[model samples]
Each structure stands twice: as structure tokens, then as C-alpha cells.
Target: MEHFVVSARKYRPQTFKDVVGQQAITNTLQNAIENNHLAQALLFTGPRGVGKTTCARILAKMINSDGSEATSEEDFAFNIFELDAASNNSVDDIRNLTDQVRIPPQVGKYKVYIIDEVHMLSQAAFNAFLKTLEEPPKHCIFILATTEKHKIIPTILSRCQIFDFKRISVKDAKEYLKYIADEQGIQAEDDALHIIAQKADGAMRDALSIFDRVVSFSGKNLTRQAVTENLNVLDYETYFTSTDLILQNKIPELLLQFNSTLSKGFDGHHYISGLASHFRDLLVCKNPSTIELLEVGEQTKVIYQEQAQLASQEFLLKGIQLANDCDLKYKTSKNQRLLVELCLMQLASITFDGEKKNSKHFIIPPSYFKSKGVAPIPVQRPDTISEQPQEPISKEPVTEIKEVPEEVQKPVIEEVVSTPEPVINLSITKPSKSSSGLSLSSIKKKKEHLIKQMDVIIDEEELPKDDFTEEQMVSVWNEYAQRLDKKGEKIMASILQMDVPKLRDNKICIELSNSTLKVELERAQYPLMKYLRKSLNNYDIVLDITVNEEIEKKYAFTTQEKYEKLKEKNPNIELLKKTFGLDI
Candidate 1:
């Protein structure tokens, strides 16, 4: 049997040049060592697996080297020392380390002490090591590494030179993994490597570890499908397919796809969040300058650009909003699957024309009707009505007719009854030669006259004129007011209920305290009148409103007035007030 080694340990970088990302920190360290300006006490603070310890080891070895090939080849293991502060975070351990700092190096010019996880040291230990760290011996050089810099005491931080390390980028990590794969004689796809890099989330060590696991799963031939299956992650194609379904407004298919995802053991939250990211990526690919912001394989980038062309800016913005909202509501929602399905349906409806219908702001989509096998009927405009030609009328003796000016005369059609002797009386008026003066007020009055004439013509039509008692009218009026209240029109309902209706012939008269109430009722009279007439079965129903300022004045509006009114109602009320010494 052969021994298997993990890629993280087997492919670790040994030199400063070989370190990925954090080039600024690495270069600064190299220059400092070359210029002999290296600080004796140094602190390395950053996230895990970003080349902090590797750089520490490389720095120790490089400083010991005298620039000769043989010196560089020598590991100088005896001169370098490594410590885990997490395990030995005590005053005695720090005291022992300080004691060893006094001894000179056996092989190297400077003895290097590397303390990993330096933040774990106790307060007493930190205080004990501060003085030695502030003024270390010439032969001893200290290098401290920690993931959390704030945990360390401020006094200790002040004594050592700090270096902030950055997380490795996906591009740099993928390139490093590719180099490793080539060295191991393994064939890896670009997308497969890209996914591995992204899964690491800016950690080189984690990326290498994931790469090793994926390589073991798929052997030498590493494809995207194998990588996604091994990592249990939703692939880019899944998101791409979801987005396409949303763009096409295929709600049923989108729901099915979501069901499949859940059946495969993926969470609805994960699916929706990834869909939001997919929308963001498509938005990024919309413009040329922002294309670089997208982090995907070259082949996938082309696919994204093609999808971006089909999706508009408005659709993408709305899709992102809906998906993100669903994501936030997922955990709190009672029906988690239904919430995600609704979000998917909304995303699918973003670009659908039928969803826009009469207004773009309509929440209920027209597709609901189509799904129920209902076809929407188009409404026709009044002007679209066709005009039919009339037949010629037989000449007869006119019995009676009204005259209009010759210049403004329009044809009037009348029905004639056949008889032995038909009588017709027609009269014509000559146009006046004098022209009328034109003014804005005159034109307004003329318009009002025309409107009144049209209303009279409409009112002349025959309609039902059934009679109803005042009690019936009042009952119907109260019912309408209650209906208004239920519909959230409380103000209108109160106004309607303020006074009872009085029937005088076909006219229903109402008296209100002020003109404001009358005006409000008049504005909303059409629907009220329609309901009243239909309920009473009387087409001749008319609502007459009257306002009396004297009636308004009779109501007790102030405290003194109310007190006077109460005293007038009962003479003993004044005695009760005086007996109680009540102030009004």
C-alpha cells in the first residue's frame, strides 16, 4: 500500500515568492529583510489559511541564509522555533521562553521564535512577556500569528510591528489549484476549479483541502458535475435554468424544478438565495465595464452574457428584489415551500406582458384567468360604434314643429303614424346677420347650457316610476350607510346616517346642519341614488338636500353652551352644579 498525502501539506509554498495573495505583505517582509530593517518583534493578524504561518516560516529561513546556494538549501531547522500559544498560555510558559531568548543560535545568525494563536495567552502571560517583547535580545527574533487581533492586549500590540494579511481571491486560489493539478498529472476543468475556489471562500488551505477531496472523488478527470455532487452544492446550471424559467414566465415548470431541488435534499432558502445571486450576476454582465466584477469561468461568462441580453434592466432589478425578499422571509414564514414557490412565480411574472394587463402595478396576474380557462374580453370605445343609414321619409302636411337657425340647424328624425291624412307643421328660422361677441365667461355659459340640454334629453327617457313609502326609503338609506361603513368609508357613512330621508311625492328630501355635509353627499350622490332607486324599484327617485345655518347654531358646540342647554332641559341641574361647586 502507498501512503496518501493531502494537497494542503504536500503542496505548501516554502518561499515568499510562492505565497498566493497578500503580495504587499510578502514584498514588504522581503524588502525589510534585505535592507536589514526587520523588526525583532512582529505580529501577523488575519483570517485563517491566508499564508501567515507559511510567510513566518519563509521569513525565518530567508533571514538565516547568507545568500549562498548551500545556505539557502539548508533548512536551518535548529535555529527556528515554533510555539502554540493556545496550549501553553501561561506565565510560566512565557517565562521559560524569555529565558531561552538569552541563548544564541547554534547554526543561524538570529534565532526565530514563532508563536501561533498568540491571542489565546492569558492576561498575566501577556503582561509577563510584554517587557521581553518590547526589548528582545539581539540574537532572538519574535513572530506572532493570530486570527483575532482584537483579543490581544493593546499594550502587547503596541510593542510589536503589525502586518495585516488579506484573504486569497478566487482567481489566485484557482490558479494555484490548477498548478497543483498539473504537477500531479490530473486533468481538471476550469469550472470545476472555479467552484472549488469559491467553496473555499478566500482560504488557500481550505481550497487545497477541497481540491484534494474532489480529486479523490473524481480521480484524474475532474468535471463540474463531479465537483458539485461531491460538495453537495447547487451548480451554476441549476441557477441558469431557474432564471430561464423565470424569464419565460413558466411558473409551473419553475415550481417543479424547485420541487426537484428540495427532493435532492437542498433547502428552499439556499435555492432562492442562489437565484438572487444569479440575477445579480446577470445584471453585472449587462454592461461592459462591470463584466470584470463577475467571477466565473470563461465558458460560463459567455453563457451569462447571452442571458443578460434577454433580461432587461427593469426585470433584473425586480427579480432581485423579489428573490431577496423571499430569502429574508423564508425562516419566519409558516409555509416555507409555498413562500419560495410564490417568489419563483413573482420572478417569472416580472417580464410577462399578460401580467401587466391594464396597469403595470397589478399584483394579480392575468395568467390566473388563463389557467382557469377564462378568456379576457376586450372593451370597445364609444366612438367605435358603427353608424347606420336612415331611409327617406314620405312628405306630408306638418302638424307642429319647432324652428332653429338655418346656420346651426341639424337633422332631427321623428316617427310618423300612417293615416288617411297625415298632418305635418314645419317652421324654419333665418340666420341672424349680426355676430355675437366672444368672451371666456360667455363660452363657459354656452358650454353649461349645452350640458344642461344633454341632461334634459337623457332625463326624458321612459323608466320605471314605482312608488315607495318614506319608511322603506329610510330603511334602505340606513342599510347603504352600514354598507359604506363596512367598506371603510366611515366619514361618508356617518354623514349619510346623520339625517333621515323624507318622501314628498317622488322626491326624497334631506335637511343637514351645514352646507359641507350637503356638498359631500352631493358629490357621492350617484352611487347612493342608484342603490336607493334599485332597492325601492322607483326610477323617479330624486334626492333633495337642504342646509340651514340656524340648525347648526342650535347645537351645543361649547362647554358653557352644553351646560346652559342641560340647565334648560332640567332646572334642578343648576342646583346640582352649585351644590357640587363644579366649574365649567
Candidate 2:
């Protein structure tokens, strides 16, 4: 059997030109080497798998080359000394290394020492090697590479030329993977490679490692499904499916999809975070200028654009917010899965049209119902109530009217003839009462509907303004208050009975102890005013409420105040208090 070589090691960059995604660093090194300005001590620092060690080896080999084809093939391994600082991070090791630094290269003009994970060296070892590192032999060159630059001492940093290696970008990584697939005679899908690159997260070595595993799992025919399955990653299709379900307002299907994802052993955190990114990507696809920001295969980009068209900016923004909130709360949430489920449900409801989700905030235009062949219902009120009843007309045979559905009654009401009585045609469509269990949103919509109904203005000039005494108005007001008491609105009833109504022209003014009562009475005034108008036959009557703090002082709210009131009523209370030495 032929020995299998991992793509990471097999396709490693051989020269500066072959290095991926570090052109700036590579060019600088090459230029320095060409000009003989290469630092004797060089520190290469960055994240893992981003070519710190690889570049060191390449630089070491290139420094010894004479630019001839023959010398180019020579790796000059004899002149290069590699050390793993993690395993040999002691003062003794530093002493031995410094001892070696004194010896000149036997094969090359300059000897190269490459130390990997240099930050692992102990403080003592670092101190021991600082002198040699600062003043190395003319023939010795040291290259230090570390993932964590902060751990290295500042003195050592000051003595070396630092090169910051950046993580490989997804685009560059995907293109490189494509080249590798072509070289290996493998048929790889673009989306499959793109996923691999994304999974690598800007590390070329990791990308190559993932590519090898995926290729081994799927053989020569590399596909997106095989890659995702091998990597145990949620595919782009999962998020696409999720987004589609949310856009369609399919909560059940979205939850089922989430369950399936969880069943596949994915973390709820991962799912929610990916969903947020999916929303962000969709938002990016919304505009032509931002399409380049989406890092996906061309096919997936087109799919994103299509989905973006289906999602409104508002929906996408809100979807992202909800998904992100779920992500942030996932770790702290005791019921993590439930938290994610709720987030998904909210996302699905973002674009929901059923039940008039936004009815509390927005009223649907009447034309909307008219467009659907429905007419507004007109409510009629008698302009004037006759003081005396008319005698019954000679019994004429009357045609019986058949009962019809409310839907049919709507159109019939629209066609009603204009009479002496005024008709109010409400333009706002009334939402049907939900038979489902109570919810705050439903309660809010009902309250808002009632407020809107009360807001409908009736012409005061056309209404009856019959003159009535303050006594009659007070009687009707107390009757309404007593009715409210029977109906369990004791707060409002108490507010009404706090003071008698004082008639000022058509206005009935009532003073209360505080502003809170005023607000409550105002909110409940619609029903109260309706009752008073109907009873007194005065549609022009209005309620005026005011708050007087003095009203609160008139009534004794505390024992001391009651004692003071008693003393004011009779001087004997004060004399009794002096005789008994009462606490009051």
C-alpha cells in the first residue's frame, strides 16, 4: 500500500512566492534578504497554523541559497538548527544554545537557528539567552516564532525585527484549496471547499487538515454534504432552511429543524450564532454595494440574494437582534434549548401577518378590506329622542327579513339609506376576537381598539344640547358611579364619589385629591360620559377633571390629623389631650 501523506505537510509552501496570504510579510523578508538587511534576530509572531514556523523554515532555506537552480534545490539542512522551546525551555538548554551560537556554520555563510514556541522558555532561560540574542556571532542568525507574543520579555522583543503574520483570508484559502484539489485529481464543489475554508477560520494549515479529512471521507468526489457531515458542522443549507422557514412564518417547522440540528449533536449556541450570521449575510445581500462582504460560494450567494429579496429590512434587523439575544443568553440560560426555541419562534413571527401582530401599533387602512370585497359597518345613533312616544301605525303586513352572516350584514349595512339619524362609518377594520388563550399582545390590541373607538369624533353641533339642572346631572353621575361599584370598578367609583359634579354650562367639573385619580377617571370617562349623555339626552356634555392637593388635607388620613381636626371642631379635645398626656 502506498503511504498516505496529509495535505498539510504534502502541499506546504516551498518558497516565499509559494506562501499563501502573507504577501506583505514575505515580500519584506525577501527584500531584506536581497539587500543583506536581514536581522540576525527575527521574531515571527501570530496565531497558530498561520505560517509562523513554515515561514521560518522557508526563510532559513532561502537565506543560504545562491539563486542558482542547483543551489535552489539544496535545502542547506546542515546549516539550519531547529529547536522546540516547549520541550527544551531551561537555563541549561539556553546555555547550550548560546554555546552553539558561538560556532560558525561549516556549510553556509550564515547559520540559522529556528526556535518554535519561544514564549514557552522560562524567565531564567530567557534571561540567560538575552545576551547572546542581543549580540550573536556574525555567522549566526536566530529566528524566534511564537503564537503568543505578549508572553515574551520586552528586552528580547526590542533586540529583534518583528514580523506579524496574519491569518489567511477565506477567499485566499478557498482558492488555494481549489488548486490543491485540482492537483490531486479530485472533483471538489466550490461550496464544499468554501465550507472547508470557513471551518478553518483563516488558518491555512487547519484548512489543509480539514481538506484532507474531508477528502478521505468522501474520496475523490468531494461534496458539500460530505464535508459538513465529516466536520460535524451545520451546513449553509441548514441556515438557509431556517431563514426560509422564518420568512414563511413557519414556527413549527423551524422548531422541528432546530430539534433535528440538536439531534445531530450541534450546540444550541452554535445554531443560534450561525442563525445570526445568516441574517447578517442576508442583510449584506440586500444591497449591491455590500454583496462582496458575504463570504460564500457563488451558488450560495445567489441563494442569499433570493432570500434577501423575500425578507424586508425590518424583518432582517429584528431577526438578527432576536437571534443574537438568544446567542448571548444561551450560556447563562438554565433552559438553553427552550431559550433558542423561543428565539426561533420570535424570528418566525417577525413577518407574520396572521392575527394582526402589529395591530396595536398600526391600524389597517379600510381600503385593504375594500380591496377584498368587504365594506365598512356603519353604526347609527338617533339625533334626537322624542319626549313622547308616537301611536302605533295601522297594523300593516310587514315583510320578514331573513338573518344573514355578519360578513353578509357588512355589505347590507353599507347600503343603508341616509335618515334623520346620523350614521358613523368606521374606517378602521375591527380585528376579530381570538378564541385562543389570553396573551398580553391580545389584551393590548383590544385596549388599543377600544381607545381608537373612543377617539372617533362626533359633531357636537348636531348633538342634542338640552338644558338640564346641576341636580339632575349629579343624580345621573352618582347612578353611574353606583353602577360601576356593582361592576367591581371600585377605584373609579370611589374617584367619581369623591366630589359632586358642578355643572359649568355643558361641562361637568369634578375635583379629585391626586393626578392619579384624574388619569384613571379620564381613561374610564368614555363609558361614564356615554351613560350621562344617554340619560340626560345631552350629547354635548363633557367631563372636566382637576386635582387639588387641599382636598387630600381636608380628610384626616392619619391619627394625628384626625386629632387636629377634632381639636378644631371642639377645644375640649385639646384640654382632654393635656389632661391625659395622650400620644396623639
Top-lDDT candidate index: 1
Q: Residue 421 of model 2: what lDDT?
A: 42
- Which residue ranges in model 1 land beyond 4 Å of their true spot? 70-75, 355-584
Score every model by TM-score.
Answer: 0.70, 0.68
Counted clashes in each candidate structure: 6, 0
Residues 27-87 of candidate 1 have per-residue lDDT tens digits of 9999999999999999999999999899999898888887765343475767888999999
lDDT of each: 0.84, 0.84
Q: What lDDT is obtained when candidate 1 is compared to the true structure?
A: 0.84
Give the range where candidate 2 is weakest over 10 consecutive residues by summed lDDT.
358-367
